[model samples]
Target: MISSLRKDADIIIKKSIDAVLPDEAVKRALKGFKKGTGKVVLVAAGKAAWQMANAAVKEMPDISEGIVVTKYDHVKGNIPGITCCEAGHPVPDENSFSATRKALDLVRPLGEDDTVLFLLSGGGSALFESPLIPGEELQDITKQLLACGADIVEINTIRKRLSGVKGGRFAEVAAPAKVYSIVLSDILGDPLDMIASGPAVPDTSTCQQAQEIAARYNLKLSDEARNLLGKETPKELSNVTSVITGSVRELCTAASNAAKDLGYEPIILTDMLSCEAKDAGSFLASIAISNSRKGDKKLAFIAGGETVVHLKGTGKGGRNQELALSAAIGLNGLSNAAVFSVGSDGTDGPTDAAGGYADGETVSDLKEKGLNINLYLDNNDAYNALKAVDGLIITGPTGTNVNDVSVLLIS
Candidate 1:
């Protein structure tokens, strides 16, 4: 049964990614571009940065130059034409700083006769951090936000304010270069301005908004960040063509199809699912329980959205693991029901495990092993909690990212 669940999850995730590869999306979006107008320069940053760059290269073989920054493990074998740099994720390291600087340098020399292809995806915010605020201050504030369990949207709202190149500044810097952005959106609803803090899109969020978000989460930003947010972005650089090529919709569609194939009635609960991890888990569990009571022979509920975990303990896991574990605990003894949550990128939070799965019997299995789910969750240790019951779903790297997908199956 566990093996079958894994297989179904893998199929759903892979089909979702294939539905929105950057190459296919870019080709469709570039249909209006006039031939031989100017040189094409590709700049990308994220877990799928290399794949996006490769897609661009395949589409435009004669492109002049390219630069991409990706997470350490996401960078596969090199492409001879494009320069690839591996950097840190969830937090920006010195390498990310250097890579950002390099990307900036590559774009600074662009001309009106050139077209800049910006490939943006998940993890780009940390993978290409240029601190308009002091480096130390930015680092401190980022740490606080992560520890506070701030959702991606809130974290990115603050990030855009502190960075010199985020919030459409990258497009501003490459002014006159005709920016064309292809994005694999990880944010719920695929907000163009929120994905990777909108490097190539205008930012409507204000300094006050950033401060409010920080205050709401009890995070204190440095004086530098506060001051930078006070200034207005210049108006001369607003030329951007942004296209969202991927999102949670793909995941829901794939999961729905997978369910149908498995002889189950698939219902997409929501594509804009967002909330605290525990609440989301419990809500899904209730649905599963209700469905079981209806005497449904087979049914699947699909949802796609990112959830947040307030870090209370030093647990090693991502949001997906936490969600799965919470659902397991909520469903304690329900029969023939299972929940699986996974990040489409094949990663979740800071852990090596992609996500986790939990069934009606998951809680009992953990209890049998003398594992305390509450204690582990309190310590933010969903990774170990799920692993104890063989619930961890490990997928090294999917080379693509949309967002988080949750599947609840009742049989």
Candidate 2:
């Protein structure tokens, strides 16, 4: 059963990522740009930024010059022509700010004869932060929104107003240069304006919307942020073209296909799944148990979306880790079943571990170590709890980000 579960999980992970590989997305989006008609300047930002940029270079060798900003550890092998830089994520740092400025400079000189291929995916918000608000203020608001358990969309809505280069402003900055955005969406429903705060898309959200979100979350913003939100979106940027080539639905389809290939009947639980991480974990486990009780010979259930973690403790872990741990607690001693949850990017939250995987025996294994699940969870230490029970899944970095993928199998 362990071997079977491992195999199934591996297949699911690989297939899910393959569905959103940035290179394929880029190739598809670039069809609109006539070859040799203009200089192609590629700009990408996210955890998958490097891989996406590398793929673009491979697909369009004539790309004159490119700039890519990715998370520190996400930088892949060197690409000769593209300038690659590492930045911070989930929170902006000096490097991220520097990269954003450089990217702006690189794109600002573009003429109507040039084209900008913008590759955007998850984590771009933090990897490139050019705050219209003061840097310190933006950082403070970001920390507050995260702590308040705001969803990705809500947080990004607020982020767009606080930034100088987000919410289609990047496209605006390179005005008259035809913009083509290829996106790997991490948000539910794949809203073009939410992914990476829509660097090259239209701004559907106004400053009022951002202000309301901040107020609703009781997020304190600097005076500069407040002032910026009052300003109007520039008019010249409305012509930018955006396309979403990857999303949670694509990942769910991949997982379903993998399950079918493994001889299991696949059921997609939901593509828009969202809630507190722990609750999602418990709900999925209950559904898994119910399906197992139905006497199905082979069953697989898949779900995708970003789940939020309300941090009360200083423990190390991510939303995926918490979900896996919570599922383990709910599963207890249920037989012939296994559950796994992983961030598609292969790093969950601040932890080095990708996520967690567990079987029926997970509870027993934890008990043997005298670990208290509730305490660990309260302390936000899901990583250690799962690690102690040999349930942690460590994939380092997967170079793709669609969101989180959860799978349950009964055999």
Candidate 3:
């Protein structure tokens, strides 16, 4: 039963991944959009940039040119006619600044008869960036915001303030050129203004809101960052149009289908799940435990959304990994349960692994090796802890990002 449960867990997770492939989602969204006869240019960013650009070019063979800025290694060989650039993610590095500058160059000179297809997805806030302040200052503030566990919306509110292209500034700069955005949402509720920091759309976030977010995290910003917080982003852009191509809901539906195929009664707890990493993990484990107590075999509870991690220790793990590790303790001796957490983008945090997974005996197995799970959880070291237990799930770059999915199973 344990082996079958593990197999079923793998199937469910794979189904979730297959549902959000950037290429397929882009093609679906393109079908509903009216592609004008203008000189079409493609500007794709985030983890799925390459896949989306390739798909768009295929759909519109008349595209004049294309530029793709994606995380390093996300680009598979290359596509003819498209300039592919690999950049930083979660944190913008020197290459990120360089690549985004070129992307901006491609669109800034467009005529009203020209159209810029902005294939925006999660991680664009870092993968495509042109800093308003010094790059070093932006980097420092980014680190602060990340470690402080401010949610994505709060982080982006401040990020839009510091960026030259974010928060609809890209559309503002490309004025006269019609901008059409195909967005694969990585944020909850599909807030069009927050996905990829809303590069081509109007930003509703104000400088005042950004300042408040900084204060909430007690982040120390440079004077330039502080001054820029009061400035408004491009709150209105007449040249931009947007369409949401994918989201966490799709992930949830696919997982549910997979669960049914495996004879499990799947319940989608929430796609809007937002909380601290550890809390989510423990809470999911508790649900699994409750089901197990009721003799509810073949049951799965799933959630999808991004969670924040307040870094209290120097650790190497993302929220997904931390979540699975935290669940390890709660699921310690329940021989019939398993909990897995994975980032749909196929990469979590700075690690190459997508996320982590654990079974009921995880904690006991760790103890037999003389390791304390609590110590690792406390240190935010889920990567190493899960590594020791062979719990890490490494899928490489999935060519997509639609936030995260955590599955709790009891069978």
Candidate 4:
């Protein structure tokens, strides 16, 4: 019974991810875009950068030259006329600084009539960084925010201030050059300015908000970094045309449809599940147990959103993996039930696995192997724990970024 349900989960995961790939969506967003009389150059950044740039050049083959800065290993194949550079993600590195300089240089020479085709996506805040402070300082600030369990919006709010390219500053740098931005949002509610720190869109986040986040999180910042936070970001940008495509909401709906196709009554719990990873997992398991009581009827419950992980221990795991590990503890002996979570981008945290899986049998299996889920959870080491039970879900890079999805299945 568990094996059959596992197959169902795999099918649902594949279909859901395939449905949200940026290829078709990028093409749709570009349908009405016409290249200006001036030269058309492309700058793509984020986890989805390479894929989005590939789609753009295909649709508008007249693109003269382009640059793509994405997570390391995310650049699969090269696009002609586009230089693809891999960079650090969730944290910016020297490659990020150099790639961003290349982009800034590309657009600085453009005339008023020139069009800068900007392709932005989720990890852009890190992958397309040009820090006003030292690169080491910027990396340190990012680590502080992540360690403090700051959400994406709050993290990006602080990040926008320090970055030379973010917070509508890239649009500012393009100056007279028209920026046609196509964004694939991974943040909840699609806050235009918060997604990828709004490189092209006018920032709605203010200095006060950024400062408030710093205070709330007790973030450790250098004097230079704190001063940047006080400086306001661009609130108005007249040279950019922005279009947002794809989000976690779309991801949830696709998962629901896939679950229905598998003969399970699918219920989309929420598309904005923001909370601790462990809590989300436990909640999903509770729902699975509740539904399992209604015998013999298969059901799938889906929740989609980005969750946070507070680093209590030096655990090597992402939120999705932590979420699944927590669910395993709750699922312990629940019969014919299972839970799984995956990132739409095909990589979760610093690990290779997209996320993880936890079924009723997981707890017992771990016990037999002298593994305690609680200890792993305490250390935030869901990756190794899940690995021991063959629960790690590795999909490599899926060429998309749309937050994450967690599913509860009762058969």
**97-118: candidate 2 lDDT, tens digit per residue:** 9988988898889888788888
Candidates 1 and 4 compared by lDDT, better number:
4
Order the candidate numbers by lDDT, best to worst.
4, 3, 2, 1
Q: For residues 1-411, what per-residue lDDT tens digits would candidate 3 score against the true structure?
A: 667777887788888898789888888888766655568888999998998898888888888888999999999877768999998878899999999999888888888888888899999999989999999889888999889989999989999989999988989887798888899999999999899898888888887788888888888887878889989887677887789988999998888888988888889999998999899999988887777877745788989998889898887999999999998878978888998989998998999889999888889888888889999988989999899888898989988899999999888
Among all candidates shown, the one with the greatest lDDT = 4
- The positional error of residue 224 in candidate 2, measured at the CA in angstroms, is 2.4
Regarding lDDT, does 1 or 2 come out ahead? Answer: 2
The residue pairs in collision within model 2 are none
TM-scores, one per candidate: 0.94, 0.95, 0.98, 0.99
Candidate 2 weakest ten by summed lDDT: 232-241
TM-score of 1: 0.94
In order, the Cα lDDT scores of the candidates are 0.81, 0.83, 0.88, 0.93
Candidate 4: lDDT of 52? Answer: 97
Q: After superposition, how far is residue 384 of candidate 3 from its true place, in Å?
A: 0.3
Count of backbone clashes for each model? 3, 0, 0, 0
Task: Tell me the RMSD of model 2 versus the true structure.
Answer: 1.7
On TM-score, the leading prediction is: 4
Clashing pairs in 1: 313-379, 315-380, 315-381
